[model samples]
Target: MSGRSDKKGEMMMVQADTRIVDVIRQMQEQRKQDRQIFYDIYSQQEKRQDPEKKDTGLFFFRGEKKAPFAVVCAGGGFYYVGSVHESFPHALELSRQGYNAFALQYRTGGAEVACEDLAAAISFIFSHAQELGVSTDCYSLWGGSAGARMAAYLGSYGPARFGGDDLPGPGAVIMQYTGHTDYTENDPPTYACVGENDGIANWRTMEERIENLDAAGIRTEFHHYPDLQHGFGLGIGTSAEGWINDAIAFWQAQIDES
Candidate 1:
């Protein structure tokens, strides 16, 4: 289905990229191969305790068993989740690169709640790493826009700060097109990209954050694509094309160092 046709409420900046359809087809192929694609991060009891969690889950894209994993969170300005346009395609691509990937379906309406869900999701994956055939080591977090803020916050402060387990932060954090300005000396290695023409998220803010990270002695990679705007997922046919590969390389470099 086209992203335009599948658009839901309050979801702005939805990209009409063909990668969405390709990812959906790949999901079907995975299912046909008897793979379980969707998993609930919250148990039935947890959902019953807080009904808001009923809308949250994870969509798995398998690669090599025991490979490092990444969690991709979609941008929706903290009001909704644009996973179809943002996260799923990225996860599919990551899986093809032989890394286990999960697209998060997080509860929206606010950033705090959403980040709490993210922390919980990370805790769940770590708890079930053996069963899921994933390596907890060198895992990464990927997100766009508001989702970028979520990943950055978690990367800076950790899951324990968000009421989850006292897990170590990701090896790397990949963020796209966000104005988040918070960071610390302890943050994970970060890779950030934004379009020069992105009005909603001023590229300068992103640059400033990267500058701060670098000043703090944290490794960072930043890219500002000319003439592109916000939410340009995968940046296909644009100057931002092939950026994900660069981010993956950055993540791999961190893994190697670890």
Candidate 2:
């Protein structure tokens, strides 16, 4: 709430149902500005030779007037900045479809220890929902690969470095080739799998972790395109459209149920 640029309010419109096309335009502009700000900040820090200054950027998309918002987390190996060209498009497309979309940025690799950056971002979303124009009550996390792992950890109410008990878990999720834990009796959580190919498919070690959450009646939808690989959710290389479509449907289904 403190640092949110007054500029955001200028672009936001209280449109009916918050259309996707208009939202994407605003989100893209915001993303560009945020990235540039971070880039320059890092540039200055680099000149100063401050090891504490991180180059990883922070950018979040915005929706129209929707109470519940959809947040997108881009996957980076806890090692590097996630793909903006690849991951952010999902936010744009979702905004076009009438969902407030945010493509979040977090510390990458071991920048701030291990996963502290991601946890901080999650906590920020929860604690600052009012400023972000999102409902603290409902959140749907969409991520692929490392993003998926982070999302799953946040969604499952699992132990996070920042802790999210103050923030409600995602109402629904779209997991594609995620990796957090083995799909076992205790993990791999069944309710979240729209299991694509590889990675999250660690069923051999734990027989589909998603089943457990599904059994608990959590709102979850699974989609699989065996032709896909790790970063399918970004809608990048092969079968990207399939991943987007499936994720949208999953989100829609959950929204309907609510």
Candidate 3:
């Protein structure tokens, strides 16, 4: 909410209950700086094989150069990319807190395809870390709902498990409002949150996932906010509003450990 005051009028266009897609469209329409909001991740030849690939890109909200970076994937239920609500807002907040953040826009065919895009995106960032002014030494992966599933899958299985190049797992994983419970032994430390009343992404399931991760000896932190709903990005004004800062601290602790 650091810079939201400047965009108060534009932000008032959407309410807490607004659908994520509508909110994203409104944000995109009100965007003033185009250069800060768009980035292409695939080459023309790659897009030629799948026209949807042309839409795939990464919108970066940069923080301190050479700091550990985060790749954020937004939730769209495998039907759309909710970059405006889930991606950009989270990335903006993380950047404000001095963490390099990238909001990924990937093909939306299904979880598998989206995960492949995420893996490739991570590989691309690592390959160009020096030029991008980001450090590959201790990056994190963050996601919401379906995107959380992607993040968890990548953290547990590594990028090579998907179709992308073989790469080291992220140092940490941050998930929000996801029902995905699958995990592998010794997965990356995780920080998760979900609204108690969220119908789409069950908070109970998330709790169970956390318990399981803890039982497996993976470091875990979770928060269940009272009376909140799904897709509450950065949880502004809600009980979960400050959870991003907490997640950042958790990620930093992992970096320190590494």
Query: What RMSD does each model have against the real structure?
Result: 4.7, 11.6, 5.9
Which segments of candidate 2 are over 4 A away from where they belong? 1-57, 110-115, 158-165, 182-207, 234-240
Residue 248 CA error for candidate 2 (Å)? 2.3
In angstroms, the error of model 3 at 223 is 0.6
- Candidate 1 lDDT for residue 232: 84
lDDT for residue 101 in candidate 1, whole number 0-100: 96
Per-residue lDDT tens digits of candidate 2, residues 1-258?
Answer: 434423322223222114345445665676767632121113454437745445443455545664566656666666664545335666767766767666666556542332344455556656666766666554677676676666666555532534333544566656656545532222222233333445644432222445455565544455555443344344333344455776677666666766
Which window of ten consecutive residues has the lowest lDDT sum in model 3?
8-17
TM-score per prediction, in order, is: 0.93, 0.65, 0.87
Q: In model 3, where do residues sit more than 4 Å from their true spots?
A: 1-37
Window of ten residues with lowest summed lDDT in model 2 = 8-17
lDDT of 1 by residue, 138-247 (tens): 89999999999999999999999998899999999999999999888999999999999899999999999999999999999999998777888888767888999999
What lDDT does the true structure give each of the candidates? 0.91, 0.52, 0.85
Q: TM-score of model 2 relative to the true fold? A: 0.65
Model 1 root-mean-square deviation: 4.7
TM-score of 3: 0.87
Better of 1 and 2 by TM-score: 1
